[model samples]
Target: MPMEDAGAAKVGPDDLQAMRPHSKPNMPSPFGRLLDRATYWDLMIVASATLLVSSTYFWLAPQSQGALFEGRALTFPEAVYLSIVTFTSLGYGDVLPVGFGRVVAVLDVACGLLLTAVLIGKVASERQASLLLLLHTSDTQRRISAFAKELANIRGALSEKSESEATTKSNRAELYSLRTLTQSISNYMSFNGFQAGIVEFGNFSALSALYDELDLAFEVCSRIVHGSGKNSDAVVMARAVSCCTRIYVLVRLMSRLHRSAATRSSLFGTVLISLRLKKPASLTLAEAAAKNKSELLFQSMAIGLGKAEAWKARGYHSLQLERVLAEMPSGSKDGWGNQVHKLIAAKLGISNSVASKCVATLVELGRLPK
Candidate 1:
């Protein structure tokens, strides 16, 4: 369907089918959530400790019959107390284990030492993870600051009239650098560490500002790339647009996770504003549906490829530079092998750059069958 037909659309079976909302998943119980939060290794350590104590108690109960301070068999409770004390290396003189019981106590103590060592290692690992995460957060902040400065320079250069070919070439080169920076930041921000940081530290206000700056940088870069006929490949433009769009989508997703309604709404508004800033050259069914940030533009972009398994496996939450792989399907008759990307951009209300990226991603993921 053409862009006009998609916009002035009619209700059809496909439209009705796509409109059907999915059922929400059942929420986990409080206890279940606690268990889910616990590492399996920690649970195993507790379980093993319990089993070892129980086994040691059973072993000592029968052997310490009439030989200890009590002139009868050591009861299960006494055996249990002994097991615990021995395991902890708390050699209290209350219960004297003679012969085989001494061996049992030694075994328990040794096991206790091993368990203690394991626990210490686990604690060290957790501390190391925390330290590394702190370092990553600091580095991300520095990068954001650097990118903001670079954007400032680019904006200054863009405002000036090109006096010569050299100046024009210089500005274009700077614009290209700006594009690369946007891509680098996009890649950096997509990591799990950044997502975890958003939850651990309630600094959405700062992050929201960063996202806004990024949006500005990307917009300026997009204008430069599209307006300058120096780059004929539309994919370059698509990549910039995709990066900007992905940033908004990821922030929106993160806002949901961090429960920052204000940040989420702000990003949502930014996305809407972004769409209106540059009226796309083409439209499709998918793009037409995306009137607001509440609509999943990037999410729908991933879905439009019809490669859910590949998308999930790669843990891909953002669109990247998949639009303009010159090496991608140049030999194909359909020109890039399929028009799926076109549909994707149209449906998501994004530019050709984003659509190209969607296609490129599918091609790279091996989702498009041979």
Candidate 2:
């Protein structure tokens, strides 16, 4: 088999592994790690403060002067118990402070109220963190499952062609299904949660698997694009376009993940969700059936890839570039190539080399005036 043929090879679940290395669960010092966590630190701080207050009260007032319970002087144990109850606002009222001890008891109660608030806030924050992690993980799992099904269907569609109308309809249906899955991924990944979650928890495996599937999809599309005949061309083009859409969405997602990871998974990025500028098309396959292979390919490059500015700069097919140039007003033809190149570079976040390639393709296509 040729390189492209090899590239188009189907990957089963057994063939894909999550990209990141498996971290051995540290068996030692579980408690130590817990203590190192922020939640643990918060609890310890409040507990130490309570202990300090209890020790101070125990020393300052004798049993008779400091506290009385059922006409008995408070024991050391009883003083500690009072501190716990006061700090928690549990006020059993079984023990009462007397004399100078009353002043210390009142202060302890005030401190307790503040500490209680802090503890509550800290616990809530910890729970929120956990919930965010869960959401990200669940979303990742969902994407992985969806990708598996999509890739399997695409593989089946491209493996053999059928002359029967039923087969053509089925291929078209599969193409649309893949497009739907790709759009879902686009929407999910546009949110910061996906990137942040993967970075923090090292879910690189899922990400790696995603990239593998995307690469395979591209291969499948490539095979179809080169081998498609007039009868199957439309269906093949639709599938190819769906592959491009998936690649584009996945690439953007990977870019965001890298950015988030580079920042060391900051709490701000991980905890706070960012808003998207606009809603993306809910259905990407709406035009798949209408476009021929060449037209579909250009459309995929122009819109399916991403923001025009971004993908144009990264580079699009010369054919797509030709279409773009041909559509420009005749009056704007002079020095238009440089302007388009610069526009692509500036808007698409691509390098000058890529922008130049896009312009070169247009020139090669003779879309530029002599």
- Model 2 lDDT per residue over 201-301, tens place: 53455555565565566556555444443335344443554455455545544544454444432222323333333332222232222112223333444
| Over 4 Å off, model 2 | 1-120, 131-139, 159-164, 192-199, 229-231, 265-370
Give the distance in Å from residue 352's predicted Cα in candidate 2 to where it truly belongs.
30
Candidate 2 weakest ten by summed lDDT? 282-291
The residue ranges of model 1 lying beyond 4 angstroms of the native Cα positions read 1-74, 91-143, 155-171, 183-199, 220-370
Model 1 TM-score? 0.39
Can you give the lDDT of residue 316 in candidate 2?
44
In the range 54-126, model 1's lDDT, one tens digit per residue, is: 5555445565431254545566667677677777789686777776666766777887776676556556678
TM-score of each: 0.39, 0.39
Candidate 2 global TM-score: 0.39
